[model samples]
Target: MSVTRVELAGRSYEVRVGSGLLEDVAVQCGPLLRKQAVPIITDANVAAYWQEAVTGSLTAAGFEPHFLVLDPGEATKSWQVLEQVVDWLLDQEVERGDHILALGGGVIGDLTGFAAAILKRGCGFIQLPTTLLAQVDSSVGGKTAINTRAGKNLVGAFHQPSLVLADLDALATLPSREMGAGYAEVIKYGILGDHAFFAWCEENGAKVVAGDAAAQEYAVDQSVAAKARIVAQDERETTGTRALLNLGHTFGHALEAETGFSDRLLHGEAVALGMVLAARFSARKGYISQDDAARICAAIGNALLTTEIASLDLSCRGADLVAHMLHDKKMDAGTLPFILLRGIGEAFVDKHVDLAEVGAFLDEELAR
Candidate 1:
């Protein structure tokens, strides 16, 4: 097992990446298991696949773990579901001292973390991210949020987890499409920074998706380590350091809005295509060479991810997509900062982008 520590200003936590960690949760969580009955939050899908291992582990460790299983997916990240989760946690009488475990993918992690943030003016929660996307991206960062009708992740908080148990074994059951979506996030790490890591991914991403143990571990570790370093520097995203992580998110969120945040375009897949747009857009602005943009698109295509927005059959024009982005959570005083690449592994926050130009660019992209 390899452990990566996220050092924040006043608090720090460890991200433990390995196989069968969920089977040893009691030992890994240590004193956080203050009560015999530990409250957990998961989705129905995850419960179907992993409930036995997780519940049985706690039962054997002398802890009676109770769970609140939610309907899986982005819809669960809503006011209605958030209210349900909070009510369930209250019924369980979760205390600030006791840690609530989030045992599922990104949706579960985000919803549970948000609940922990607002519960009794903030309680503690641990992340047991079962999916590759959650393990590498969302689980490490303290950014917890739910979706509002206005936009994705518009309602949320910055609540750090007590610990992150990324049990690689859990990924063995993931569908190939879900695994491909997760790989988009792994590619984001390299696209935003670490050129060498990007090259490594280009070579070994297939192996990682194929469930090669060493490749999986290395991809998760490197992605988490990159995130750990960035989070340590800007835990709250007050500085620009952490914003770099949004390499493809700004465009991706717009794509998600177009799809009504449905499974039609999973967040990771949207990101895959979004990175392609960012690359091409950067090229349009003369920031990067055309070859760099092509290479970016090629890498995404090599991973079997979407490189063309036209394929998704979005119902709106480019201007409509821009309208959705205007509602983004990252909007600062009516100025939205877009993360664009100068080249592979070199991403910068561009605040001077013209919305009119962006709208026109999306129009061109849509007509393609």
Candidate 2:
């Protein structure tokens, strides 16, 4: 087992990554429970596979486990579902000091964490992230949010989990498409900052996705540590330092909106293509060489992710896609900042981007 700590002064927490963590969850979370009843929120898909182990563990520890199984999908992160989760937590008689367990992927974690944040004006919650995307990115960042009609993650809070347990065993059950979706986030840490790690990913990404134990552990540990360092520095995103984490999110979110935020483009897949777009756009702006942009696309394509927007068969024009950015949460003072690459492993925020120019550039990409 490897542990990475998110150093947030008095709010510091540990993210433990390993196998069998779920089977031993009761002992792991024992110190955080305030009473016998433990309230857990998860999606129906996760409950189908994991509810038995978690229930048995908590029951064996003499704790009464109560679960609220929600329907699975991105749609679950809506106002209606948020209200349901809050009401369920309220009925659980949860208090400000008690910890609620979020036992699923990003959707469950985001909804449950948001519920914990608003419950009694802020309670504690632990993240039991069961997906690769959650473990490597969402589970540790304390950015809990639900998707709204306007945009993805537009309504949310910076509610940190008290502890995060990322169990590698869960990946064994993931579908291949889901594994590829998660790999996009894993490669993101490299694209945004670390050149050496990017190279490592270029070589070992296949191994990591193929369920190699050592590669998975190293990838999860390194990704968590990198995020912990950034989150500790800028917990609220007050400084631009933390904004670098959204390397491909702006473009990715726009693609998501165009696709109706459905399974047609998973968040990570959009990110994979977005990173390619960001790299190519950077080259167009004379920031990076075309070869570097091609390198980025090749790496993504090697992972079996689509690297071109042209492949999406979108009926909308690039201007229509740019219109989607108008509602982006990152838009500041009517100018949306984009995370563009200067080179491999070098990303910077460009806040003065002209929407018209972006639209034109995207128009070319759409037709390419």
**TM-scores for every predicted model:** 0.99, 0.99
lDDT over C-alpha atoms for residue 88 of model 2:
87
lDDT of 1 by residue, 57-87 (tens): 8888889989898898889999999999999
Please give the lDDT score for candidate 1. 0.92
| lDDT per model vs. reference | 0.92, 0.92
Model 2 lDDT-worst window of ten: 173-182
Pairs clashing in candidate 1?
A: none
- In angstroms, the error of model 2 at 211 is 1.7
Give the range where candidate 1 is weakest over 10 consecutive residues by summed lDDT.
Answer: 25-34
Candidate 2, overall lDDT?
0.92
